[model samples]
Target: MKDGNLDSIDKRILYYLQQDARRTSSSDIAERLDLSASTVRTRLNKLENSGIVRGYHLDIDYDLAGYPLYTKIICTAPVPDRDSLASQAQEIHGVTAVREIMTGERNVYVNAIGTDHDDLNRISKDLDALGLEIVDEQLIRDEYVCPYHGFIDEGDDPAPDDVDEVETE
Candidate 1:
């Protein structure tokens, strides 16, 4: 979030990784960009140190892995401090993600994934009691699960009986 730090090569390296983290290895990046693997590794390490590359993650299908619920809760209120409110929200169990989104009036968006509706309800209650007034609370009923395309949901097809869908265990 600084000004004029990223050079052209740095931006290209970032874009390559962002497109497909697993597909492109350090060697592949070096080969494509015409640099040695050690150079690429150094740059990647720098990016990580600088906080540009936050973390690498693998896409997982939640529903197939026995976590089918994707619940999103939107809360609105006049808070004394934004950072403290965010921290408190994250403290609540089952709160996978919390973000302060400013669409029209400023509000906090809560995204939680639960194994069932009961778990989601518990999380909802936690959000309510977090000292923030609720403007809206809506469940993302149709949970989308895809490794590549997030918007295109694979639908409510139950996991195969014989197949055991495991996460990154």
Candidate 2:
């Protein structure tokens, strides 16, 4: 809470919200943390106002929703056209996410979902039309990593026990 830093209580609130923001109420958080409901509400409001808490979002199960094919496309565009290409990609029907990578052979990374292989192919073709040279395309077989618990721990630095020392070469 000091200068945009999240203290222990704020981190706990974030942890509970991250698990299920829509369902977790301020009262529930207050009861669990042994704090008053109004206190929790005030703190949550502060968090929101400070931009530490962005808007909550739903994690859709695209596969269950009938869009089974999830893919990541790595591509590059001309320096001047990067923004335009990204804007166009975002407008594509199935593109869920688009990111501009600052480093690497490929400058843009796109995440898209489709009903099947043919649908995915069409999405790729649409991207190709934007003048981006596709360097690689990979189907996301599984998402083993996630940032749902990213704010669980307090402090910027890692715990002493979490780090290991290496001998100098």
Candidate 3:
């Protein structure tokens, strides 16, 4: 919490354990931050041993679980074959994610989900037979923005009319 620097009560115990780590309890985040349920279990075990609390996920929905076609394949190769083509596009069958883009012109980026558009064109012909050069292959017309809203001022102190005050050129 010192070098990692998440001060304000460890960002309010990671904004109430990212909004519900299994029904949020460290005595319900120490009674909503008045503190002490053993100091929110010692700062949620030092935010899970300083990895800044990494493992609690389960949003799913993948188009209501029927895998509603959301491809995005962007590939490219030969920079030493980009980590063996992102580890063979993570073993191929409906690759959920494989990003290895060190910086543009597509070094590899895959996110797959199927059951339509001919199962995303058979995962874009299994990523173009893995020789890697399929520069673009879109299809996800909707995830407007995500990150599922976790960290934004759970640490507070900005709202004095949302601040705006300097005047002395």
Candidate 4:
């Protein structure tokens, strides 16, 4: 998948797997699609090894765990040390994901998880201290999150002290 060598069958396998990670495998998919089990298995293994299918997790109801808020924050750091600046933003609470998005006008974006708008801003200040010329920022106040598509589940929260390195692809 990383080499962009996936065919139509590979994409179909991924679509079905993403739909329901709990009830998918080479044999089951092969039975439905009329493809050989070996083919499905090999394609799946290739996707896994190449990091396209990064990992799997059971979709948990986050409300039951007291994490009720869902929000996103985009940050722009027109600084040279983009990684280091992104690192500083990653130190704040609720800053679950941070990355230097681009090198031009909008250089950084942060996806944060918090219960309130104040919390997002509280985290933004720590990011602002990196000495970057920020062009602008947009806060996604409300939206529907596709649980099946993101990198992490609702329960496997990243701690405030954790450092995250975002990959641009």
Give the number of the best model, judged by lDDT: 2
Q: Name model 2 segments beyond 4 Å from true.
A: 1-4, 79-81, 144-150, 154-169
Residue 39, candidate 1: alpha-carbon lDDT: 85
**Model 1 misplaced stretches (Cα beyond 4 Å):** 1-4, 102-106, 141-169
**What TM-score, computed on C-alpha atoms, does each candidate reach?**
0.73, 0.76, 0.33, 0.63
**In candidate 3, residue 118 scores what lDDT?**
82
Tell me the tens digit of each residue's lDDT in model 4 across 13-50: 77557555676678876865579999999988889899
Question: Which ten residues in a row are the worst by lDDT in model 4?
Answer: 160-169
* Model 4 / residue 110 / CA error / Å: 0.9
lDDT of 4: 0.62
Count of clashing residue pairs in every prediction: 0, 0, 0, 0
lDDT head-to-head 3 vs 4, winner: 3
- lDDT tens digits, residues 33-136, model 2? 78999998999999998888879876777888888899999999887888889889999999998998877669999999999898888988999998889999
Off by over 4 Å in 3: 1-22, 29-35, 63-84, 87-95, 99-111, 115-117, 129-169
Candidate 1, poorest ten consecutive residues by summed lDDT: 158-167
lDDT of each: 0.67, 0.79, 0.73, 0.62
* Clashes by residue pair, model 4: none
> How good is model 1 by TM-score?
0.73
**Tens digit of lDDT per residue, candidate 1, span 34-56?**
89999888888888887878898
- Deviation of model 2 at 118, angstroms: 2.0
